[model samples]
Target chain A: MSILDLGKACTFSQMQLEITYKGEPAPAAKVWRRVKWQKEKVDEFKTDEEGRVELPEIMERSVMQLLPSEFVVSQAIVVTYMDEEYKIWVNSKRSPEKNSELDGSDIHLKCELTDERRLVSDYESDFLTSCEII
Target chain B: MTALDPLNAAELADDIYQVEDEFTREIFYEKYKDRFELGKDSGLSDTGIKGKTGGILLKYPHMMAVMIEGKKKTSFDGQAVFAVKGTAGLMDALTDLNAGIKNARTGGKVHQGFLDVFDSYAGKLPTLSSNIHTIHCVGHSLGGALATLTADWLKSTSGKEVKLYTFGSPRVGLEHYASKAQRSIGAGNIYRVYHKTDPVPMVPTWPFFHIPDGGEGDFLLPSGLHLKPWEFHSMKRYIKSSKGDGSQSLEWSTLRSRRPQDFLDSSVEAWLKSNSIVSFTLNSARLLSAAILWVVKKLTNLLGISVVIAGSTTFTLLDRLAMLMSKGLELAKDVSIWVTRLIKRMAQMLGIVVREGAEMTMRFIRQVFIQAHHAVSELVRQAGRTLH
Candidate 1:
């Protein structure tokens, strides 16, 4: 945690992310997630044979969202497969609400390795990623 | 495999941006073909997220970098040099505006925007050949911040000698990061060169500290009495200050001694009380910065708190700073005058109207800090706009 260390504000959320190489599931790929505001903690997981990784709801405590300033907890989900890393998710989440990344919808995404990174924008923020909302 | 001379390093930092355009790329390669070898991936490009404006999307070129290998008969023989571009385009302006603190992979916290830009291409950084014995990282402005991170990474992973040369680079990290980087990179090997009037280096102030801390090997180039931040921050202006010849040591020999430590409390107080409105000069700004740091240190020591605690990179540090200054106002008379003088000088520099005794309020002084930071961010944004 960086700015969060100074105060006691907390936010919690969880998401389901799927990894694929070409058309097949990407099993055993290491998925890394970090909340930009709470950067000290990095959540790591290994995808199952189905290429599905369940991110347990993360409850990060920080004062950044409480401030009357720009609230951006840059969310990054990168996957390492076959010694190469790919950015599956890169977003600057502007609101602290759960699932606000997808306008209050559940965090379900299908990411493809072959897909080129594209810029996607919502009212909250802009995301540069290869993942599509499922 | 030696370090690049100051002028050469500045030029490389400036020229790295040229490769972003095809025509300039040809000219760049032609100019250095005899002294260096560039690969296809040498010209680096990356995108930045831009805010949606109206109904149309605009092309936002975020960052550019160049990786050059020194050929035989050149001073950088067997050496690898990586230089990144500074602020340019609308997206870069947004990047400069993203000034939140985040955890750095190497050790401490760094600017979130700088880390994001670096991370976008960190995986793509070309690997140096085994023949390369040393890595020289160079950049100006935002590129300088990225270069600092690159030097730290190369030193940690590549196990090669790393030398960093930055011009008009902003403070990349906090005190913990600065000390850690200094110890990791070896203080003497880091060269943080800046013009006396450049506003870029003065930003992300206080808690955020520049590396090679205590200015053991830093170079402070003096400038004319009046100069704009953009002019002082330009890489061309830096090249003008440094010598082009192969000699690396003599170009900034006389400036090694001109660090922030040169301004003592007495001098700072005298200058502040003099009511000199001409405070945009880098020295005056640095003096005020030094004075503030000094006052905070003294205030903490007086309150039985260690400097380490007060210097922590916490979000409430600004609030704590104002509170401490308020307490300093009540506890010691000298501290009171120092605080008042500091607020006055800071207000003058920022062009904020503050009447007498208004500095007595913690909220008022805290607002000053916030305004100061906002001013710096605006300056960086302006730089980004004009650089494009």
Candidate 2:
């Protein structure tokens, strides 16, 4: 599973990550959860020196959550086809944000590591606003 | 097609005159000179490529990217072909084999590399037409892979027959894509060239050639055929060479090469007949250090039990732990010494590797941007995704 079950779903807990022999952290590791996360309803910040999105809010966010720059669209992530590995993409959708004249459907991503060490655009879905009141 | 274009084996045999006199390797360096430097956004790098005078881009990667300048000269009939300049690395070196030259990723990057191989300027392909004419694609090493990708792209997009010419290319397809690619660019259409001793076109697994254990149809598994962005990314630098039109001065011809087999015929032959020691080794000190770390971690989690002594002589049941504690400390110190030394060495290596890798990566990313930009610019001229 992309996110490991640390048995802390919806509750407060600290989690450790499973590392592969290759020395990279699993895509989704279980870390501290349910801590008093302070997420601002509005987020506008740049990545810190570490290239991690140090959100003012308690919750950490992925790069996809940021503004759309050519940078995000130009990265790579590996996925296996049949058994052989071929790289598809994690780049900008080929279609430009122009009038409906072009192919209008260039949906591919670079799927790679960017200079920031963040996985670029490969956003599963664009933003959909949500809210909860206490 | 020109009088020189339609080269039958016999006709091709005659034209095998010395091309070395006209085209030297210098054009390869001259055309993509800017690639020797890096982009402002990418920061700087030291690629350590050859013939480099003092310049901004240093390190291996900056050497990877030379600026790509493209110019097209038509056939006598005015068909447009493009030439660019860039450098090649592992990916290009690997995919320049007969088994390696297929798939969009392998092809895409290799094509870019081919363009970058020499200061390119060559015959053009006719503008988009339904007519079945062939696009002649060619390169060496990574450039060869790029040649194959260019042909594949042209075949898929241009609705033209693709005549590919490659030298020492790597395995382009996993077991999956090879068959179909082989068929599309028939033996007649595709001429994969290789000289005797070039180990480069054969190493590295990026141009994945073998099928998993008992996986599938050829060494290429079906999954490998999916030309995804990652695949192209795997060999992007090689693709940089596709921006080729070798010089009015072409590169040193492979035909001029004295095949490696001829140079070391007997020893190589004997080894092929009998030596089979494909092995890798581990460092003993490193292994021992790892064991020490594992043991220390376990001990750190255990609770320490202490007992107060009522008299001059203190007798405790769990006091045996004293010996264990001392031993663990000694091991920990040893491990620390080794670890610190190892870390320093690793840091030195990483610094050099990452610095160069970053430079190559930066140049590579720029080319991807440029290529994607080209595709975007051409979006205006693109018709719907309908096949001709």
Candidate 3:
């Protein structure tokens, strides 16, 4: 199991995640990102893929889990790629707000799941409890 | 009204000192001494009331003081007149000088009305019980009309004298103040003030009577000294150059504004926080997603791929995935909302219990305080008896 961390600020944008089966070469791997308030699989790639995605940028941002203490997140994000589904559970290590106005409004468009599966929609989906950072 | 239109502030100020104040105090008395006296048979009393110094109107231009002394309902001393200026509305086209609420918003006049202006002269009026002797009226535009009507009303009442001074009063009535008011007010006391810049008073309004070209109405007085206004084109002569009347201008806006500590007030801050959260997430996502879609679209065209084929394929794949996620989120949302509502009801129940408990405790504490006071008083009396 590969752990993925996609952390963000109150005003963060463009969250992405890629998935690969164990022992699969990078070229055979897929990437995902949050799109239009809904989770979507916009691209398909592996280790040998030609998409110019940078690695350090996503890691530098993975400072903490989405939720710190109360609840353990089962998975950070789950992507249904074609017939098969890819799942990654991430722990969020941040404090919960005493008051949350709404999930998407507070922190929306967070994680992006990229794989060979094209799963994003024209209309955005809300980000409420879709992913557990902690 | 003279065919020469009307005199402007600049024109009136000129040749004003020459015609009126030019004569010594003796000369002023001589000119007006004859006309003021009626025919010998008129039976008018020349009382000590006319002993007042200076031109009656100009000396106290604003009726700067209104005090009620001794009896609360006594007749007022000095003039009780209100000058209302149409600083805004259609009347703006009528006069160069505008004052009041209409002028306040336009930054042309003080916002405070004539009744409440503390900085300017205040007219003292006795309480509701007193009979008002007279109410002199002066104004330009809509204000002018209101003043004339007020004066007319005062004259018709038990009051023997009601003097009116208007500056370009618009036609008050289509046929002159309901006829009876005209007769009671009499033509003698009404002085209609006017200037060339004041296009408001003529107004094609009825009541054909007009102010004469020479300053002859009621008492000819300079509206104010416009000497510095006309001679030098400098605005400083007319308006104040200081920040606010030499620093004692205690304005509400100055005292109560959004200060830095206001953020700590919490109640107001919470709304701002909530709105920003909604705005930021929704807005940024919209722009980013649209840009991505645009890039995908442009690249698809450049690759020589059939534009429609690439567009539809990409859209279809993303659309299906979005639809599924949306449905799931909606379900979660419905559940979350229900939970929140249930929690609210539980909190209300808890609140009722807590409030009852607090009230009972407070009652017990109050009873104890009363008992302690009585016991202390009894012990003090016992000690006094033993000492005796």
If you score just chain A, what TM-score does every candidate get? 0.83, 0.18, 0.26
List TM-scores for all candidates, in order: 0.60, 0.27, 0.22
**Shift of residue B105 alpha carbon in model 1, Å:** 0.9
- For model 2, the local distance difference test gives 0.27
Better of 2 and 3 by TM-score: 2
lDDT of each: 0.65, 0.27, 0.27
What is the lDDT for B29 in model 3?
24
Weakest ten-residue segment in model 1 chain B by summed lDDT: B47-56
- Measured with C-alpha atoms, the lDDT of residue A71 in candidate 2 is 10
Q: Which is the better candidate, 1 or 2, if ranked by lDDT?
A: 1
> What C-alpha lDDT, on a 0 to 100 scale, does residue B30 get in candidate 1?
44
Q: Candidate 3's error at B30, in angstroms?
A: 36
Pick the winner on TM-score between candidates 1 and 2.
1
Query: What TM-score does candidate 1 reach?
Result: 0.60
Better of 2 and 3 by DockQ: 2
Best by lDDT: 1
Please, what are the lDDT tens digits per residue for candidate 3 over residues B1-388?
A: 1111122211111111111111111221222223222113211121101111122122232221111111223223322333333222222222111112222111221212221222222122222224434444444433454445445544544364655545444444322222344456665555554432222333321112233212234222222344221111111111121112442322213222211121122432233223222221212222222222232323333433221222233332223222322232234553323222222222232232223323223233233323322332232223222210
Candidate 1 chain A vs. true chain A: TM-score? 0.83
User: Which scores higher on TM-score, 1 or 3?
Assistant: 1
Model 1 spans > 4 angstroms off: A1-134, B40-63, B72-74, B89-98, B225-230, B244-262, B272-286, B299-317, B323-337, B344-359, B374-388
